[model samples]
Target: MKFWRWLVILALYAVPVAVFFTVGVVVVWRSGRCWWLWWLAPLCWIAAYLLTRTWRKQLAPPAETGFVSPGHWTPRDGEAWHVVESHRRHVEDIAPGQLTDPHFYLQSAMDLALAVARHYHPKAKDPIGSLTVLDLLAAAQLAIEDSAQWCRQYVPASHLLTVDQWRTLGKTPAWLSAASNVTWAATVLMNPLNFGRYLIARFTTQAATQQLREHALGWFYLYFVSQVGFYLIEMNSGRLRGGAARYRRLQADLQRTADPPVGNEATSAAVTPEPPAEPLAVRIALVGQVKAGKSSLVNALLGRQQAAVDVLPQTKQVQQYELRVNATEDRLVLLDTAGYSDAGATPEQMREMQEAVRGADLVLLVMDAASPARRADVKLLGELSAWLEANLHRKPAPVLGVLTHLDQLRPTLEWTPPYAWREPSRPKEHNIAAAVAYTRQQFGTQLAEVVPVCTDVARGRAWGAYEELLPAMLGVLGEARACALLRTLHAELDAHRVQVLFQQLGRASTGLLRAGLAKLLDAPT
Candidate 1:
């Protein structure tokens, strides 16, 4: 059955090719030109096809979810991004033979992997030596899983292929390779001139084809190596797994004192000072349009009228206030930002807002229900969203929409407490619900939730400040904590990366010098 299938395939393709060759030869003979020249067109066509084809298929990053990473397992450090990008540029420059040949490919891959490992683990010449058997096995398992995922996505129904079908498919490549060798030998032996032309064409075509294959494999290894490098860095930093334990260990290390020098009892007094063990404080920024009752909300949250409340926008700068939890050190820092105008804020005001948002772990976007025009607020939200996207390595600060002036929504005479906006029965409640819905719809998924709040501090009739909004803020506390942790980690890394790198280099140079001096002393005259 296989023999018959092969015969049919050859006949189907060979007949047309033979007919075209014969017709070309006849035409060339009639024109009194060399019939061999007729093959040039086909050779050029093959070369063009090989050169024009798109070979490299893009591979996505490994699909491992970070239990602690704020932004859905994406790399949280600039160093990780740097290593991946650098490796990609280096890998793509790999020679065609190195990428296509198995032995060369493996050698090149190992060399690149070591380069990445060295960048992350600079103390060790061979970073893999530090990894245990389980670590190595885990890496292999991850690679296997990524391979399976690639097959499932790119190879379509790969799992459904029978063992016999797979074997037959595998043999197809060997048969095609043998046929190519036979064709090459036959063409070379035909005539000396033909052989020269054949060799030129074969070289051109094969070079193009090999380059395409090189690009395809280059792309595959580029993504694979990048993912491996990213995880490697994360693992080394103790951020990937056992993060809490690692954090504790880091704290312990920081608190630990160095041993005293031998025979120097006085040196024992000189110990490392323990860093202040302050709990992570969640920073919340109240941002909205001018006269959106942000100041009132701040006053209510703080249980005092500390923020100046006036008819005009009094808060010209960011005013930070601490919301301390009673009987505990756990506290939240509230940033009351200057509001944007209906037309929008000035560049300076926007800059201030951006700085406030950058430092915030959570944002409370105060929206006035009475004011239907929220274009300015929407623009601010859009800008913030873009900023967050640009900085995905940082943990995202969750935004919650606070629909303020619920009492001012409908029924001018009514001042209600405890309005059931979720399942509204009264007209005022319904209007409040509609306002919340409108806010949510306008913002889309930008807001985690919209809570209807009435921050009427001047009237002394504040509602939803403690009931709805506070609880909503506490609800996303876990997410906010993750963001805080990531924020602290990146900050610490940025501050110490250069210092640590210099220290390592200093130690390495000193050790190398010591070894050289020792060798010189031991040398015979």
Candidate 2:
């Protein structure tokens, strides 16, 4: 494949040189201009041909005779032959047959790790506990550390070869290097000539100037094509210092098995019992429009003011807080994101919020009871719903709709309790009758139960309402939901472990390859 590619490259360069020379000669002869123009045609062709040949020679495979026996080869061939001999010697030094067939050992280790991870995927909901997952992770880490050691040991000697030493050692073929050098020299010389022609075209009146411009453009295009091709090859073939490939593969596998079961709430509840001995820690993200009182609500549930609360939009970035439910003593992480619908927020902010919510085991969509009917609030809700549908296949965590600013609503005068309520200071007549009517009308069927929350930041007494909301929120999630949430969290940890393992493996492979190559080329004959 490499030889054919080189042949095609030579053909491409040759065609252009032949055309330039033939055209240049014909023009010079007809015009009776300076004979130098005619000389240029032959000079360009010879330089181009020689450069191509040098590149090809350098690329040629090293002679096999040097590896078989040094006595049968010339002094120049000795270096090339010694590289292979040295590689074998290095392998023997480490362990007999270790360098010769390292791939089999590496592959076997990878296969074992992969099998272990797979075994634990479904049964061990807590990915960390599974023996297979842990083994895979350890394998990946070991691979990378080994590779680093190998590179440190061998790279210095590999870089010591001079042009002759390199050729002798068969590190790189002489012909290939010569051809590359010729091509590079020609390119450097031609660029100045082409630029000069462009300058002349700008300042002088010459019909040939346009032709020169076209030729320069063609060369530039060819250069760009070559550069692009080189980049593609490098990107595809280059190995990382660490086991990045193995890590990526492991990540892919984990992602496939790690996704939590969705839609079947009943089945999930059955699988995960309410009283798990140890609950997995979970992160929950709360997102909503500005002035929806997200911070105030979180503070109320936490039983402490960990987040800043203000009537004005204050949260600018995602902030996380650890909350432990008094009932279970199980820890839950609450991620409060910058308020949406703020003028300063960009699309990227919205995207970050979306991603935060995507990873959450629960999402709280807070709305203001005072302005639930407002256009901005409605639009925000619709947008959030749309985003959720587009991004998530399963229902994004258990969504709890929180209504804040309940203190502003009038309690009595035939108003609702959960939706509308009579305040404590209402008239004597506005008592149980008003509360009963409000409950019957609003909290009749739609919601499980509505708890009023006063999220007024200045009052400081509004924390009481938040206290009431917490127990209700916990009840809504229940023990079954908590177990599922724990499982999901464990799965994420498992995925991370798998990725780390594969990355290590890739590193080890790279080290082995580099070490083998170095000894083959640099060892003393």
Which candidate gets the maximum TM-score versus the true structure?
A: 1
Error of 2 at 485 (Å): 4.0
Residue-pair clashes per candidate, as listed?
Answer: 0, 27
Residue-level lDDT tens digits of model 2 in 1-525: 146644554464366467667766457546755545534433434444454455543433322222232111222223323333332232112332332354744443343333333332435333234443334344446455655676568656644656687557664456765775575466448545444433332333222223233333433333332332222211111111223454344333333222233221233445433444454455667776787788887777676777877455454568889876544434568889877663434577667776777667666656566553434434544566676555322233555556666555454233333332334444422333243344335434323444456555566436334344565556545432433343453455556667877888999999999999999899888
Q: What TM-score should be assigned to candidate 1?
A: 0.52
Residue-level lDDT of model 1, residues 1-525, one tens digit each, is 124433443353355467658776457547645665546544654545443343222221222322232232333454455655665666645665665566864665466556656655567577576554444554555566667898899995698998899879979978987897787687567544456655655665555555545655765666566666655655544343333344445434323212211221122233523323675677899988888889899988889889887766645579989986432233589999988888987898899999999988889988888888988988988887788777655656889998887767669678867888889998998898888888888989889999888878677668998788877776675566556666666677568768977998999999999999999999998
TM-score of each: 0.52, 0.36
Off by over 4 Å in 1: 1-277, 311-316, 326-329, 505-525
* Number of the top-ranking candidate, with lDDT as the measure: 1
lDDT (C-alpha, whole model) for all candidates: 0.67, 0.48
| Candidate 2, position 406, lDDT | 59
